[model samples]
Target: MRKLVIAISMLAFAGSAAFADPILDRQALMKERGKIVGGLAKVAKGEDPFDAAAVLTQLQALQANAEKLDVDALFPAGSDAGDTTAGPKIWEDMAGFKATEDKYLADVKAATAAAPGDVDALKGQINTLGGDCGTCHQTYRVKKG
Candidate 1:
């Protein structure tokens, strides 16, 4: 099931890449990331049944997602004009933005390596990952109602 999910995700990403609309592509990627995080959060908060394998699967998915991110291509020079929540800061400080993205990828990699076997451990991993997400969102994302 994990393999199937990964395969399907890969296919979807590949299919999406052909279109090459950075704004929409980036939005889709972030949405998938959010969904993955939300699933993990449900388990961490005891809202969903904790399955060690499922947790690992989600972590692996996050790792795969992070591994495939091409931030430069995703947020090109002219993409800021469209329907996006990406802040101007992303373009102004591209290096800083990439650094933050790198930190997020690192955090996700570490959590996946830790492979939290239970809910308590999963909560810690989720907290760390969530902090990384919040850090990027707070700095790089424009909040819109």
Candidate 2:
């Protein structure tokens, strides 16, 4: 009976790991992006000292993440069945989702090019980048509790 219970627990664990793999991967990606965005926001809000070099690094990281984001693969058919905040519209309206992703990438590219030299300039670029994030989230993401 103990052996049987152990086998069942192992099987359950394996099943859960398989189910959560994609969601965990996507969550990690989003968390990295969030950290970069949070730093940018702090600088923009004057909560942190404006370091141009750091801003450039963060922008570069953001741009790279945007480029690396593979929406289709990252968001597979059953990937959203877990604890994801992604809305059903992402899969339902794939074209629109792709368009929103493209817009965000474009905004990040533009912000990277702008490379704000000071806090004031950074604020404007942050606003543009943040707007892209806002628009995409509002349309494609569901708020989680």
Candidate 3:
């Protein structure tokens, strides 16, 4: 009886650990993206001086992350239950979710290629890039308080 209980406890712990790893990874990825956006926001708002080289580097990093982010793998089944801000609609309408992801990736790629030469050029691209971010968050993510 004691052995049975121990085994069950171990199995439950293992299951939860497996579930948690992906959630943690996804959270870290989101935070990294958020930091990149925050930097760009500072430049956009004139809180920070616009350095074209720095902005281009950040945009490249953003593009790299976007390219490597596999939405389906990051968001496995049952991931929406825990510490996640993802909405149920992501699993329900996976096609739409993927479409949104793809659009964001495309936008990032375009922005990276454009590589805005100055603050004004960067500002011009901000609307499109920010819109992509906002659209996905609005449609797919749950608001956290």
Candidate 4:
């Protein structure tokens, strides 16, 4: 039983170490950010109207990229993911951190899907998505020097 527990713990640690490089995670995040923001900007401006085609394309790409960046793995619980500007508050306030990512993805997906049908309504949803971002930034992110 003890050996089994140790094996499982070791596997979990190895997985975290394999995936938890903040530099790479940050880079992955930046790519997703660019796609999601640019995608939604097209919607906010009402640039595409009924089509929303470009926004949809970018949004889909954003979602795909987002799936690769896990909020749970944002912290190096045991292994080092490097010195993140993320701060210890994120790890300590784990529920808050997870909720931010959860809402971001959900809001973006729902809003993007509806954009093609009702541009105005979708715009409102998009604003909510942006608001989620503001909330997360307020909690988790530090202002750039």
Candidate 5:
């Protein structure tokens, strides 16, 4: 399932006209993150549910795309992508933003070992990952845009 989602993410990024509604896209990404990370936690509980292998496999893939992903594309500079709700501080504060993402990937990599039977510990790590998501959203996304 994680692999399928990653494949979709990839296809969405690659397609030239794949412009998802900004607000809806943001919600979808946040929800998807919750589901995938939560799925890892369930595996840690020894529930034998959700394909942990797929999650593990896509962690690196997601991170790779994430590293290159410009959330600001939701608010492109010179192109005709139209006005986005993302703030200009995203570019002004890019270093911090990339660090946030790097730390997210790092956390996911460390937490991956908890898979198949380490859900509890992974759950703890999962919340920390949410911190990154929350921080960026708070800084970059407009609440009602």
Candidate 6:
């Protein structure tokens, strides 16, 4: 029926509009980045066996995720509202925020190129990567309860 079609169209538009919010988009991307780091962390912590290929795969995925992050677009002016945990420093010091992002990407690319073959190597790589993540989070993220 025409009414059914209209209702379905409205629902689809509503769903898409919800996802179109930049806050939601950046949060989703950050969640995915966390998952990739978590996967690598398991191996680094020895909770998971170190498989060279698997570690490389995760590193590559991390690179892709970092590369996909467009901080300017994702964290545009006036997008600091809603459920976001972004710190005020991010907007106040946009240049510093972007520099951190660039550093993270560079570290990921270097680690990927290095391609750790053993647990020790992977641990070192993870440490550097984790440090980069921590620095950014400490400076640019707000803790929410």
What lDDT is reached at residue 85 by model 3? 91
Q: After superposition, how far is residue 13 of candidate 1 from its true place, in Å?
A: 8.5
In candidate 1, how many Å is residue 54 off? 0.6
Per-residue error (Å), model 6, residue 67: 0.4
**For model 4, how does the per-residue alpha-carbon lDDT over 31-59 read when each residue is reduced to its tens digit?**
66866676666767767554556666766
Per-residue CA lDDT of candidate 1, range 5-78, in tens? Answer: 99999998886764388888888888989999999999999999999999999999998887767888888898
lDDT for model 1 comes to 0.90
lDDT of each: 0.90, 0.86, 0.84, 0.67, 0.58, 0.90
Off by over 4 Å in 4: 1-20, 46-50, 78-83
For each candidate, what TM-score against the reference? 0.89, 0.82, 0.83, 0.68, 0.54, 0.86
Residue-wise C-alpha lDDT for candidate 3, range 58-84, written one tens digit per residue = 999999777756777788888889888
The number of the candidate with the highest TM-score is: 1
Model 2 score (lDDT): 0.86
Cα distance off (Å), candidate 6, residue 1: 38
Pairs in clash, predicted candidate 2: none
Residue clash pairs of candidate 1: none
Which of 1 and 2 is ahead in TM-score?
Answer: 1
Error of 5 at 110 (Å): 2.3
Candidate 4 lDDT for residue 37: 76
Sort by TM-score, best first: what order?
1, 6, 3, 2, 4, 5
Clashes of 3: 0
User: Over all chains combined, what TM-score does candidate 2 have?
Assistant: 0.82
- Lowest lDDT block of 10, candidate 1: 13-22
